[model samples]
Target: MEPVLRNLRIGRVLNEIKKVPNCMLLDVGCGFNHKFLSTVEPYIAQGVGIDFKVPNVSFRKIRAIQMKLNETMPFHNDSFNIATMLAVLEHLEKPKQILDEIARVLQDEGKLILTVPGKRAKPVLEFLAFKLGIVNRAEIEDHKKYYDLTDLQELADQSGKFEIVHHRYFQFGMNNFCVMKKI
Candidate 1:
């Protein structure tokens, strides 16, 4: 129903947000509009959104910054209570480094909520983007990889920075949802 799936991912992230107390959030790859940040505005005390392309708009509780996720963030250690990388991991060239950086910035035991397309979505996504012309072709073309639940668990285990506290599949098993706590 949505274009490939932004709304579904946002809903999943919001559900994870509700499990934690009010927090200062770091939203990785918050796009030009800061839709997710805006949607969660009431749930967070304040927020910082970073991406390679973000507008200069200044919202009341958000400071949008144009920065690359591959580089270390400017925040101090344990700077945020929660960090989210909704649908952003698959596009990163160095995803583990980015996750490590996220872990560095999050307070101890803080949560990292993320969603990535499942491995099964490869052909489905390709068809939606190329044939049906529904999903964003640019995004599908940019995906570095798709992951399964085992892949996610292994990645987090290898990082030694986070533990996948909760995980589930949604969108008819086309996507993965995870709540990882900083170890």
Candidate 2:
């Protein structure tokens, strides 16, 4: 994971977990990268990591599920204290739909934490490719769209089921930190 993104997630998650106890967390689009998971090991009672493919890790404590983002989450309602989607929302077709599902599965007043690249963060590379008449962006990369601060803020506000507890600009707001609480 990139340092800026990784650190931002770690910091936000730690702060959020401090407010709750016996926490069970759900990590969406967890991939194989579990740095943040390891960081919260002390506070987490049970952790579930879901991705399209399972990463090779020997730890049996962390439950990794293979699943698609656009479908229903397999867990029961109000199953977790916190749900995290790190560097993942931009990859999905209906991000708000996913958030609704997250709200469904999380306890009332549960927390959702996520991070995504700000709209301006990678514009230079994208623009240079345009000038060179070449598409350098990775096709498999899950970034369907990049979001500016206002877009993210609006998404948080109109998320349908959750209240934006805290939203901050990261990496100069070219990246964003969003904390939503289930209403």
Candidate 3:
């Protein structure tokens, strides 16, 4: 991904989570770098990162777990105060199931922060990222779908356990950012 786009997404997520202090965060599909978790470590009290693969580096106050998003999360109920799934929801084959799991582990007052490629700009992004080689093709292939605001709202609705708190387009409408609260 382009640094500017990446910063926009990551920065938006970080900014939203910063409002809730001393939060225990669960970063779903945190990737091998634990990049997001590491970036937010200073603000959060504790954090756990789960992905299909292990991370290459470890940081204090953050635990890394290797687990696929499609499967049951290993944590118990009400395990976290905040949960984030940056750029991960569109790639899930079972997004509803995973959202259910995320809701299960989050406190009733917990918040979910996430980002996905905007449906309107996805095709153009694919063309630029893949054919033009402006972005990583390998990363683009991992996405099963791109989400517009409506699609994201529907997913939150289908979860039956969350209410959309905020939704907006960012990065010049190339991406969608959502903040949902467990209900």
Give the per-residue lDDT digits (tens) of candidate 3, residues 1-183. Answer: 466776777888888778887889999999887878888889999999999876534568989988777888989999899999888888899999999999999998799999888887678878987789988887788878999888988998888899889999987787888999999
Model 1 worst lDDT window (10 residues) = 1-10
lDDT of each: 0.89, 0.76, 0.86
Each model's TM-score? 0.95, 0.83, 0.93
Clashes in each model (backbone N, CA, C under 3 Å)?
0, 1, 0
Top model number, TM-score: 1
Comparing 2 and 3 on lDDT, the stronger one: 3
- lDDT measured at residue 122 in model 1 versus the true structure, 0 to 100: 94
What is the alpha-carbon lDDT for the whole of candidate 2? 0.76
Screening candidate 3 with a backbone cut-off below 3 angstroms (N, C-alpha, C), the clashing residue pairs are none
**What's the C-alpha lDDT at position 84 in model 3?**
92
Minimum summed lDDT over a 10-residue window in model 2 is located at 133-142
For model 3, what is the alpha-carbon lDDT of residue 5?
A: 70
